[model samples]
Target: MILGCGLQRAKKRVEVSRTMGSNTGDQFANLGRALSTTASVLFSAQPMEETILSYSSPYKKLLHETITNTGGGSSLVKMHRDLNLSKGKNKGFQDIYANSKEFFKNSYSDSKTTFKVLSYLSDDLLEDVPRDTIPKDKNLITESGEKRARKSKKQDSTLFQGFEASLPVINETIEIQQKVTMNSDMKPITDSESSVSNIEEEQRQEFSLPNHLKAEKLNNSYSSTYLKEAAKSITDNLDLLEIQKNLAASEIRELDIKLEKLKLMRELVFKRVAKIEQHELFLEKHLNNVKDRVDMIIEYNMDKEISSSDDELLSRVSESSPRTGETNEDYETAATTPLELKDDDASPLLSKSIYQQLQAHERKADAPETKKAGSSKKLKDAGMPNRHRHRKTYPTLQQFYETGSKIASFPKAHEEEVICLDFDMPFGTMCSAGSLDHLVRVWDLSKKKQIAAMSGHLASISCMQMDQYSTLVTGGRDAVLKLWDIDKAISEDNGDHSEDTDACVYTFDSHVDEITAVSFDGDNLVSGSQDRTVRQWDLNKGKCTQTIDISFATGPMRSQRNAPLHNSVLLTKEPPAIGALQCFDAALATGTKDGVVRLWDLRSGKVVRVLEGHTDAITSLQFDSINLVTGSMDRSIRIWDLRTGTLSDVFAYEKPITSLHFDLDKIVISNNEPTIKIYDRENGNHWFCGEENSELGDVEFVRYKHGYLVEGRSTGDINTWAI
Candidate 1:
């Protein structure tokens, strides 16, 4: 029984020893485990053995070898007891570090929390442990502790010696970094006291940070702010430059458009200037021609010698220029004085005619038959009246036009100045004349005598027309348009009737002002007056059918005029007046004083086309089916293509064109000059009908058709030429 009791006590003793060993050994192993875990987390996935081995403590190799190779045994427990005895004041630090590392790794998963727990535990341990218990010298309570203590003391001495050696460099580097940071974030510290205070404040912040972190904070602050500001400034500059570039591009485009327009305008001006220069040269050439012709005729007259009878004939021709076909008793005797010119100013055409007459008188006694045959052939080929087939000489007078000599001349046909004239065409058997004396006379070309006279107009006749049916239409200045039967007027003038009926078959009076122009085409009559309106008349109805207001069709237009009012010269502006008119079947062309020609569709009374080129009042206009020809006081005749509304041809004359007529073959124009000008379209030739010594007067009204030219002169003379 005593032996059994001893065994039980022995077993109890072994149990107590094992429990004590496990408790103490576990505390040491846990202390090493917490340190290894902290080092692994801070250094990133390092092995437990290497982490433990990196420490320079005397127990480092043993702890790493035991944990990695042996795991746990008696030697580890003995080492733990030895460590407890050697570091008695750090016992609570070991326990807290081990427990917190377990909590951090398993539940917290943060190295920062582990370090904070270690720091708090270390602070409490330092407070709880007695200062006397802390070891001061290298000596230890055990033999192994003595060796570990000695090694630790040697390592501490070395570390303190190295720190003392680098102390000045570390301080200088920190001071320089602090100064740079202050200058960037705030301002320069010029005052010594302020600089010292700023240094103190920076030192306090640096002290709170770890030694490694102090240098990083100093390097990053100033450089990041400076780089951001510089980048922002560069971005702003780039944006501004981009805006300016876009603005410049837009301006360049606008300038390009304006430059193109200016170029076109310049080209147009150049063309107009060139045209004006060419017209000036043409006028000068025609003037030279006229002067040459005049000089040649004068020299010829001066060089010739004449007999007394021829001289007497010439003097008689020059002196008593009486009405054609007067009795010989009315002739005055010729004076002994020679044919003379006052101040060498004789009419060039007059001298030429007198010289030709003398030559003709001399030739008549020798080959009178030969002369008559040649004259008859010339008249027949030239489309003269059939009277030339029977008569050997001109009907009334032996006068000639200066250029194309005339076949007949009714000199002094009217009691006053003749204003208008017309004749039947193709046959050319009858002719009519109207005068400023308000009398209309009809002449029979077959008999060479005046056969009819009608006196109904109260004012001067301005325009007249004749149809194939013995119908005559005349417009007078008294705003009266009269139509007469030519046959009845002639019968009445022959004293064939006893009735006192007026010759006027129709008298329409819709015009309110002086009629300026009139046109008659078959059954239609169109008239224009200074009232700025065009009236279309139906002869079948004998009334005004359509009235086109010039002002309404053309709108308000201004013309420049120079007039003497109240003895003062002033420039005036007025609306354009209707100055010319032409009518076809349903088409009418009206010209305004402003030089605008408008083509009207009479059915609708609306302007269809406007022809613009003349710069003054239009004096005359005539159009065929395909072309419109207009004459202006501006000295230009423009022919326009009606189908295309474009100018096809233009004729520039030396004097203002007074009257114009054109056909398919030729264009005839009469200006202020005594000559009648013809433009032959087929051969592109210009012919003047008046020559150097022709007694042609300034023709006021003229008509040409079927190669016959009838001109009414301002001197009350009527002449015909076959061309």
Candidate 2:
């Protein structure tokens, strides 16, 4: 038995020693595991820290050798746990190590829990870790960190230095920009403001007036100069206007004066015209009265001649009455009772007596023996009255011989002076006076009585001519020519005329001036006028045939002034100024105021001859069968032989010879002398004279038979004388 107990004790001692050593090793492992796991948890939770600590571990050689042989940190942690638990747990001493098992379980649980809490603390602490606290494993981190630190320091330095350095530059640049902008903006504004101020100044200057206009305006504005200047201008204008008005008024006044003068002159002229007209009327009335008396004398003379012839016829019939009737008284009365007077009023006894005388005169004449006897018997037996026989006889002037030496004379026929005279053939005459009163007298030459008075010519009877074709043509200064029919005038007094009888057959209004004379040639009439023209008219046609222009040759005479003899002789030589014209067939003879007489051939329209020698105008011309007798103011009568165109004879008188007449054997001359003179043409001697009781302005003489004279005087007196 003693040998078994000693071996058991020794085995127990050996097992206790082994368990202590294992417990010590297990505690160490648990402590290290706890530390490792805590560190791992811290590192894993902070990966940047873990990564940094991996290289910067305090046990870097051992941890590197340990992790290098193992898989990594996780594998190391797992292996360490396993080795600690396995080695720390004892199965053969189960009853002796049961308390250690609980200890181990609790430690393991706490460590794992501590590891988890540390892991969470590490995660929380990572956001707060500074970059400088992060450990670097290589120089890369250290160099990078150093570089970054240097760069950051440089950036900070650059930022702080740049701010400090750029402040003045930026401020200076902005100030320069602001100054440039301010200068640029202010330059234009300054220029514009200056321009505006200059413009306002210029406008203000322009509004001020010039010196002249200013002075003028001021003068008219406030002082007495204003009123003075205004008054001066107004006065000048008013003076000019007044001058023009006065000129117009002067013109009007002149017109009024001229009008008044013209009106007064017109009135004076009209009054003179009226007085002239009244004077002419008086003259015309006297002329007409003389013409009527002349006509009455002619009728009375004719009646007296008829009565004397009848008295002779009745005396023969009474002597033939039977004494102591041889047969019965009734038978004797029947046989001689005016021869049983024929029913025809014609007187057979007178016809038989004239026929017997003519036959006796023929028988007394010798005849040719060869004349047929039957012709001689027929000439003897043929019986006709001598009523158709014409006697070429004229009246003689017994007083003309006594007054032959006198050129002019005046006789007392009437108390008034005789201005004109005309003869009414067969015992009638007319006369006019120079009185302004309108009167003319007609006288009967046979009875020596005034017959009637007639009037009406607006002017003096300047010239007169008798047409002798039962009409008288007269002209006057009234510029009119009137024709009077003498036959009709006498017929009206006889109470045997028609109411339509034309007393005045025609009138002419041709002369623009005074009619100086009128004359007729056959049926043609000629008029002379102061218009210096002689107009030839066909009185029947009542139209002008020719206008003879004598004005050109007679212009000097028209301008002549009637003056005293010595003064008038100093005037220019006057041409033949026509005063009267006479037509002898187709030839015209003009008596001119200039004493020269002109003869014109009507067909050739030229002057044939100018008869000179008279010292004054030819007052009258008488044409005869062989001679032209002219009476002139030269107090001489001249006879022209027409065939030879020569002055045949000249007779001198004491007065102007106003008229001349020619008969077959005698020449009669009338002057202003109150007598008519008869001259024997063959002897050129005064033969007979007929005296008148008035100035014989005109005269006509008719010779009836031997020594019988009939003379007409200006006093409308006709004297019959037996010489």
Which candidate wins on lDDT?
1
Task: Indicate which candidate wins on TM-score.
Answer: 1
Q: For model 1, how does the per-residue alpha-carbon lDDT over 287-381 read when each residue is reduced to its tens digit?
A: 43334344444433443577999999989976887656645332222212233423223466333222234344445657555543343232222
lDDT of each: 0.60, 0.50
Can you give the lDDT of residue 437 in candidate 2? 19
Tens digit per residue, CA lDDT, model 2, 390-477 = 2222223222233333312234443433334444332233333221312333444434555444344565555566531334667665
Off by over 4 Å in 2: 1-416, 428-444, 450-454, 493-502, 552-579, 687-723
Please report the TM-score between candidate 2 and the true structure. Answer: 0.37
**What is the Å distance of residue 205 in model 2 from its true position?**
99
TM-score of 1: 0.41
- Give the worst 10-residue stretch by lDDT in candidate 1: 384-393
